[model samples]
Target chain A: MGKHIRTVNANQAILRSTLQGRGCGECQASCQSACKTSCTVGNQVCLKEKKQ
Target chain B: MIHKFIFDDTRMVFDVHSGALHIVDELIWDLLEAYGALPEEELAQSLSGKYLEEDISEALEEIKELTDKNILFSPDPLGGAYKPPGESVVKALCLHLAHDCNLSCRYCFAGQGKFGGAPGLMTAEVGRKALEFLVNSSGERHHLEVDFFGGEPLLNFDVLRMLVDYGRSLGREKGKEIKFTVTTNAILLDGRIGDFLNKNDISVILSIDGRQGVHDAMRPFRDRKGSYDVVVKNIKSFLESRDYRDYYVRGTYTALNTDFSCDVEHLASLGFDNISLEPVVAGEKDHYSLRDSMFSQISSEYEKLTRSILKMTKEGRHINFFHFNIDFEGGPCLPKRMSGCGAGHQYLAVDPPGTLYPCHQFVGREEFVLGDVFTGVRRGDLTRLFRNSHLYRKEGCGQCWAKFHCSGGCHANAVIHNGSIEKPYSPGCLLAKKRLECAMYLAQWKNAPDKS
Candidate 1:
């Protein structure tokens, strides 16, 4: 919403959805790309838009 | 928002916005969230279902008492705009004296000591201007702190001596007390260096990463040799200088040493009293980085170290850990914070050739450069960007319970790991919360009644 921004859907951001049922359901996905960052048990993965 | 940590009989509630603390029962805690939303009559009716009418009234009164203090129902939930301590005095200045180091620390934030740029030393002319900037900008401040920092500040000891002399003379003229501190690895510290430090009234902070094996593995010579023996030997010599009681022996811990309680214990055995251990900051994929898997290991070690410190204290030993000595009760009253350290406003970092950044972590980062020493601070787009980069403006931090304590967290690290200064690194937040809890427990332990 600031300027020159892109929003991604759940399907776009999440890659190799976990078998543990921790899908990116209600979670907001700001990036629409193959996940270079892993979806760990701890919230260390960068699921949101990459910051400056 | 209140982040409550459960102890034994009571829970410690920390108000993230104001840093206010409240210890309350389960009933009062539950009503804190539900009571604020409804009208008094409706709230009383709703709460009557769970308790007697008299109990409901008492609960409402309690909520009103806290609400009056602006703790529970804060008008500015995001902790109003960042306040710059009234005046624009240059109270503290960190001078990047040497942008090169003899040791290649794996977690060196300044890019292997050269700052990801050409290796160079701060010239005498530049150092003189830095002093002038500090004295001129320090308005009405009697005490100003000047820190000599870098890959190794001891690299250019000549310029350091000259600057100290000039700064002292200027201090007397301005009726100010200029305190000088240098952060070094102690590899270059010799008899001459030690004598110069004491003679010029310059205090030194020696960096030695815990035990021999862990330190040598993490911090190695440029040629990849162990530097533990040399550093320890020089540290002993450096302490022999005049008035040496006022220095901190700082160390950093990484994945290489998950059993870092041993490091703290090792430092105590080495006869260093004032000791502080820091968690190493490294990239996520960097194998030596502290990962989710290492949390339990680190946590257990931290607990062990805390117990050991209490044992040592009981034995009449003066050894101390920096993490446990913090006073959560003494932090700033809510409403005047954006970032972790007072970066843009109160503090500023200066690299060679006179470029100004908010702090030392972002020294080599050009995009974050505020301005140079000559042109003064450029209050335009960059300034706005830096000022706006607080907890209130940060995305995830707005709802955080540790918001004020961390203040949107470290800007450089957020950008480096998450890709934006607008984002708060969750790992850093977890670390801060865990450490704060430990600090609190230690404080409570110190004030505990004698069960004996």
Candidate 2:
């Protein structure tokens, strides 16, 4: 009951322990999410996404 | 800004700007809901009915500590300070090699692959000019990508082969590394094509709409013959030839098959590791188009898919479902996160005749045509228009909790549905938010202590 907050990133506490260094770049748009696999660079929103 | 929610038994809060997540207990969760609106004593008074004075005080202390660390209620890092990159260089091009396709799928968005244009194939000369344009427009960027698209790129196999070779030589001469990818229905994929793809290190995107029955119903040939058998067989053999590397199967879910998770599971069961099944974009008049009424069903399917992915991961048979692939820690850099896909800016699409558009979806629309490969992007006004279309500039995105994750959604979808890029398609918005929730929830489960 006393423990109330768990941080997920480097800002404070370790929030996503298993996801610490995982995930692609900060996806800014839904290009990847919209067509993801198929559209590859169809929209070219997030530069860091793995090249299709 | 902070977004908080409860999934299963865990309560989590996400700081949008800093991209931080917090798991809080019930007391802290409730306190956060009222934290900013009232004074500390007033907040405690409001929650006194449920918690003791000592407990309320301790929870308040925890909240204070977290807030002081800037982990919660973080300020917008781009508050009027974000400046667009000084120069936008072309990085990727979707080259529509052939306007004519062998399949006439009912849900074909490109008007049966011709994209509302006359059936034609891109000549070798046009293909060469397109590659040269990309190389010249790329500026100082070392690595570039070119995707061979069409009614079917394989239909123009000879020209595509020559272009790939020419692109390789051009890359070596210009000090650029060009990566190639081709998206096809797989009707024409054979051993030779597969071998060429592998040798060229070109990635492949195979189109198959899940199970044989479902795929056959949606994607059929010009003769109305089901292409499921041929497509799957070709894909299987192609995967075998390439040793199953750098490829993914992409599908579209329409009103015809709202239970799309089954399709995802079907592909997984078929031994395909990477897969993407997206909602079909069609006019409201189209019988197979998704409407507001169907959202609940679609959402549930997404949930089912999430659970399936989690269970599969537990068994060491994880399928890389594209939508669920969210990187909280390693997402795009800051500027890209705010700007979204660089369509019309960093990316452009070339039709068979070498006419350029912002992206593939906007190919046939004359208004979106930027210029041809010969003259380069002459429509500077259009480029500027797309360049300024950022998440913050989008209408109604300010209050959305998932705005940062989706980066204001797809511009083309918005234009098609609402007639303006600033106005988002509400259905797509709702679907994207739901997917983001599922993705975040999956992330939570994967990081949970019980995960193996």
Candidate 3:
């Protein structure tokens, strides 16, 4: 069970890294707010990260 | 991986990265979303309201942003931040290759191809210089296009070849592509020339009004003989070749050829991919005695021909009316001020004697000369000609619905027809409005339920 959870966590980290590389690729977040209405998943992730 | 998100048109894919939509450039996006498939007339009507001013102002700001991004391009080949009064981006260069022609068409704008007053053939040296000028002036990033025009470009073959070679060399050096096109009478086009042209990937626009009789009446050789047979034979020869078969051969027609049914079919049979029908510019005499009845008859014939062509294109017949049709998510038609006409900004045509004019049509007008190409491109004069802010119609055209679409019509034509560019020229404007209305009506009809 612990090994399975570790694997899941590793997958999540990989996904998060990919998303981070792409979303913050420009490094300038000028278009982040403008895209909120269009991208619910990204917005939720951003909000969750903010809370964390 | 580029996550693609398409809005409005599925053909245009908007790249989405993470949650943020990767906007190619703010101008193109704004132009796409702002207009939102609204036909010109409907768009105009929407803009007629007072409350729309703020929205338009905001859209214009986005357009400026897009202009800065370099994604939304002007038709002008000369790259600059210069915006003319009430004009959109410069879209095309009206280059004239030879002011002299073998044929003396009655209504020839260069005065029956007479050599006395007008400038002669553009030299190979001038052509190379011009190509170099275009490459340098277009900046390091953008592609360049050259349209070889004249009383007849074939008359000056050496210069044309040199220009093409120079353009290719410049393009290779700069890591840019160059597009070359020529407009000619086709009387001079032979089998050898046709084969050479086919191999070179050059676009040829032939002038053959409708039929032999109609064409002969308008265009005749210096010896007063009809050269229709020779032209038709040459076109057939070119079309028969496998290489030239796919080449874009556009047929230019004048309004005098009123028999739509016969002309359209005849031209189509000749293997022309596109047909550009222009209304005859009434000379000094005809202008005063312009008849509404004559115009209506011509308009009706044009409408019928356009309908047939549209139907053909819809049925996948490959015939395109490029002068009227726009590509998917394309920039505004002639009217949009966002990227105005090429004129003094993007392109300047040099006559034989080395006087640089805004365009070929304005070549003889001494006042329009930007400078001599031999002395190098005059930045000051070119700038003054380009940023003629006084030329823009802030009062009348700024508030117009078609402001983003038509860009207030041709400046040279306006000055020639009317006394100034401040007021819109009647003929081109009226014709554009009529055409736009027809396009909108057709779009609606196509979407409507069948009547069967």
Candidate 4:
């Protein structure tokens, strides 16, 4: 079979999964608007991947 | 459903059900569109003229392997009748310290901070009661959050300081830990206030719209004078005092500034590491509402901003754009992913007068007023309504690929525009989809094997 597709699962990334299931807990705490925290839920568990 | 998009020569596919992402070659990408419609042999036979027979067969096998692993085209995990946990606890509250604002922002969502009522500041007693209500309603949740929000919270600086101290003492006595944050316009952020926030380990969300022109245009003072100079000066000092940590330089981009990415870049250039730029939410008739015609321009701006972020990361200069900050591995759990920011249930907003609303955005709406803090969530019906507003229950989210990421979008915006929380605001949805596409593309590039 042709292995043409390359995939990266979420598990491979170096992220702190500690905030999972806390659902908008911290975001609602800091948020002032509806759209402000659209992607901020993940921000609670801050993405640490910085490719240099 | 698997969502696919191409950005800057990169083809990325997102597995909606499993929240898995894949970067595929052109062949597999096209093949995926027609997948599951027919048997493997029949599918290959139909595309024989376009692709090699052996290549088609091989790709089908690969797809089958991923599907079997439940990484691609996975079935919906919640299945049809998913019931949310019955019990709800208050985990966070947005406390409006002052209902009046110093600078009259043209895009003021809370009707210039008074929220259509007489301008007032929260008394210390009201603040104390709000905290007490949170403690009692929180049940077993030990980690509670309270945000000092307002037309301008600094206007009630005395009450805010008193409440922080009171809340901390209450937490200690109750064996709970409370985290505090404040959203301010930076107009009154002097050295003393900065020291208090830093010492208390309180996070700050400083409001500064981008470049001077764009910021002043949207956010100006009572006399119509520009606030950019004063705000920028104060924020720079505050950022340095905090050692450049635990703060967000947040802004809102309106239709007037379609090149919103430049505003983000402007903030970055000013030495602010953490930034969040959001689109303005206003009635369609408002001049700044982000009308339909401006979507493409705004979308392109997001792409440009994405590239800028990558460039900065490649060098030593690092920044955290709140919107692009996606956590792949440690994202919110399925339930949180299905039901976003538990407004009216887990999270609620308290007005200066001690009345509570679902969230900050709904503070002025009479119908959304849940109850007074003294009474503690008298409207069980409204709380249940928000608890039931899950991804599957939303009008289009069940079939949409970005459901898990956005968690059915904002309930307040939906209710304001569509008159129901079950419906999503189309304009907000459009912006979200574009941002998610860009975010996935960035994730793919960042996690690529070649980079490592």
Candidate 5:
């Protein structure tokens, strides 16, 4: 009941710019900037979850 | 790529995409790593100088075996494309019996049972319509489940009773196994109610957090009094009529109780054999919310709980922890999976007035309302959204070592935590990975047989 796919794609683009610039690079190999939790740098969980 | 982690004596590698797990010895591990970089001939040459031909070939055989399973495969730069969710039959329906709750818990996700709407109870007419909807929409699935859900389903005990009778009658006529389940706070449970539940063979999910202080601190009556004493008394009374094995003691751990293993211990001490602990879902500002800082502590507590279970298991008492019994083979196979639980696809929740929802979590949210019972289902818009919300459609799930197993985790939590269902809640995402790792560790170290 929502036109979310297009908005999601657009938001993702903006999020990518903001998060990546702030060092919160995308972790999932499946999608760009897919993880939304504020996992700080050097967090082991984020490190392990990142693409190998 | 397979993420490999080596322990003291064993090597574990997870193929996130294919949903395969590989646990090998040091030699086979070396072989797999070497093969990833070198061709078979070159790989053999590289490892041949250090090992015997037979041993190397055995390792090669292992690789070949893994290759057959797609656990080991050549990488192609060509990536995947979004595949819409296949038409899946509805096998389970959650019936929200009451929109009002007696306990106004601090972290109540449903806003104290009314969800976001005014307090109300479902009518028998609505319940009958919901049952009809489930039977109509469930396709040809011979096994169907109906869960009596609520702020406190007991609040609408009459409707629930009539619905169960109606469901049983319908099941007999249609030749479907209509299993019923109820998730309750146990406050309204009494001797007569318990007997009815057992006689009707209705499975119950009892909510009892743990020790008095902790349970009462989070969950309190509408009168602003602690509910621990009343809940425990009611739980014990309920079990007297029903077999304890037919129910699960479900608890939610908040930030206040990060050391939650003690809660499990308390439940176990009370002679409850089945237990499950879920983390509270709340905004970061909420005092009881599980924040980023508590992830490690909570994860460690789970580890402790696992150790305790192992000890109990060795002592000849087996306790059922819901996640530990997760059988991937018995679960949805790789091809049939979408991201997170198959909400809206394989499962649907019906609200008080017969409004259909994706699942119980989205019961009150207007944005997530798929449709109401009167108009059948508003399939086009919501269906396409859920169809496209598959793991493969999301670019972020690729190469995650836990992807196939986690299936990108829960959609509701993603939407709640990250402001979008398209994203992953990192804390939960990380905890799941940790849990999988723990489950794997326990299986191998305990010499547990392949339950898969």
Candidate 6:
């Protein structure tokens, strides 16, 4: 039972890393962080969070 | 899990799983808050249709990324949020060390060029308090620069030393650096004084109009004796010292000595790197105003001066035309929000008596007083001056192309000439444009081949 649980935790860790990578890769590059591009007006339209 | 919070017109989204908070773009957050009940899929499709020509699948994928970062959050009929280069960052503080002077130069702006209206020096108590106020008021993580000025800063040696020591101590305590400079007459600069200045990293700007005849004609002692010899002797000694190579001494020339071509060369030969020539401020007597002919003559003399400096610079020398040109993009000189002059906004000058004027140039007039320094720096009156002062936002100046560069000239000069700060600063603005144009012409000429 202990061995099985350890294997499941390892698989979950790998799955989490994959999801994080995909999520970060798809976000708009121009809006690195919100504060950095706040002065620009068009940066608002590029915001992906609002689209969803 | 994603959590969203909004404050101060900013939105922050936090990811519980990653312990990371991502701030959303200001505009996007505002749009989201405006459109209250849009489903994520429908919103994504609409965004794709309206803005991007890309497929909805790609847009949805991008939205998922933002959602994962916690920068985007869904509303449970509750709430959600997020979000916020450099031109010239020149910050300068003109510190008035003493309201008194030892020698009365004929054209002193501080009214100290004469003996009558000179006030006493700043006490140690006042100096300490002022330094504390300056240090505390300035935000953390910004460069602090102090420029020592007065009728003459050297006359009040005790207070100067106290202020310097205080600055050094505060710098050490806060892990911040402070730079010091002084504008003075070369008459008081001896070998010992030069050594002390070099040790303390203080740059000296000496006022010497031109050669013996011209300098003496403009800047004479109270007893009317020529001070050229004394000042020259001091300059010679200071420049000949062992550490002279490291010392920075710039010559400041007034407009009265326009006829002295030889004097300009003399200054260059005296080992001065930078030279600043300024037009004499208008006074009660019509002593300094140039006639059309005289102005032409002065312009010719300036051309010669520029040639001399350019020649030296070619031979690995450096020179600066003080009023005409400044290296705005090169270094951090003063705290200017935009690439413009500081008047009525970034900084204000307060006199020894604690009266707040727009700048150092208008310290004497009562009508120009915004408030007393003792009360003004803490209150809202300083901001009010920006709104009410004509000099701050003149209609003509606002529409002018030179607005970004000159900021409509100094507020003090405007108030003095027009009797109201709201009027256009025509004199200074016209002079500044002429000077800049002349500098540009000279620069072009320097780069051109010798036609002769």
lDDT of 1 by residue, B324-366 (tens): 6544433222322343344554467788777887767778877
Model 3: per-residue Cα lDDT at residue A44: 17
User: Model 5: which docking level applies?
Assistant: incorrect
What does the lDDT read for residue B224 in candidate 1? 91
Give candidate 5's TM-score: 0.80
Candidate 4 per-residue C-alpha lDDT over A1-52 given as tens digits, one digit per residue, 9 for 90 to 100:
1277777774533211323433334334324432343423433441122211
Identify the candidate with maximal TM-score. Answer: 4
Q: What is candidate 6's lDDT per residue for B156-261, written digit by digit as tens?
A: 7767777888889987886656666677777678766777777787766667766777777767776778888998788768767644543333333345666555
Model 1 residue A52 lDDT score: 11
Over 4 Å off in model 2, which ranges?
A: A11-52
> Model 6: what TM-score for its first chain?
0.18
Alpha-carbon deviation at B360 in model 2, angstroms = 0.5
What lDDT is reached at residue B212 by model 4? 94
The lowest-lDDT stretch of 10 consecutive residues in candidate 1 chain B is B331-340
Best by DockQ: 4
10 residues in a row with least lDDT, candidate 2 chain B: B329-338
**Each prediction's fraction of true contacts recovered:** 0.00, 0.21, 0.00, 0.32, 0.00, 0.00
Show where candidate 5 strays beyond 4 Å: A1-52, B6-10, B16-20, B26-35, B38-65, B68-89, B328-330, B445-452
Indicate the docking level reached by candidate 6: incorrect
What shift in Å separates residue B270 of candidate 3 from its native position after superposition? 3.0
Q: Candidate 3, which segments miss by more than 4 Å at Cα?
A: A1-52, B1-95, B114-119, B242-255, B258-262, B286-293, B310-318, B332-337, B379-395, B399-401, B444-452
Kindly list the per-residue Cα lDDT of model 4 for residues B1-452, writing each as its tens digit. Answer: 78888998888878877777888888888788788887777778888888998888888888888777777887777774457878888888899999999998999888888999999999999999999999998888777888899889999999999999999999999988888888999999999999999999998989998999999998999999999999999999998998988888999989899998889889999999888889887888998888889898899999999999888888867778877777665555565666677887988999998999988888988999899988888899999999988778999878887777777788888988899999998778888888888788777878787752
- Mark the regions of model 6 whose C-alpha exceeds 4 Å error after superposition: A1-52, B1-91, B113-118, B242-256, B260-262, B291-297, B311-318, B324-339, B353-355, B370-379, B387-392, B398-403, B422-424, B445-452
Model 1 off-target regions past 4 Å? A1-52, B7-11, B15-89, B199-201, B240-244, B329-339
lDDT of each: 0.65, 0.79, 0.50, 0.81, 0.67, 0.49
Ranking by lDDT: 4, 2, 5, 1, 3, 6
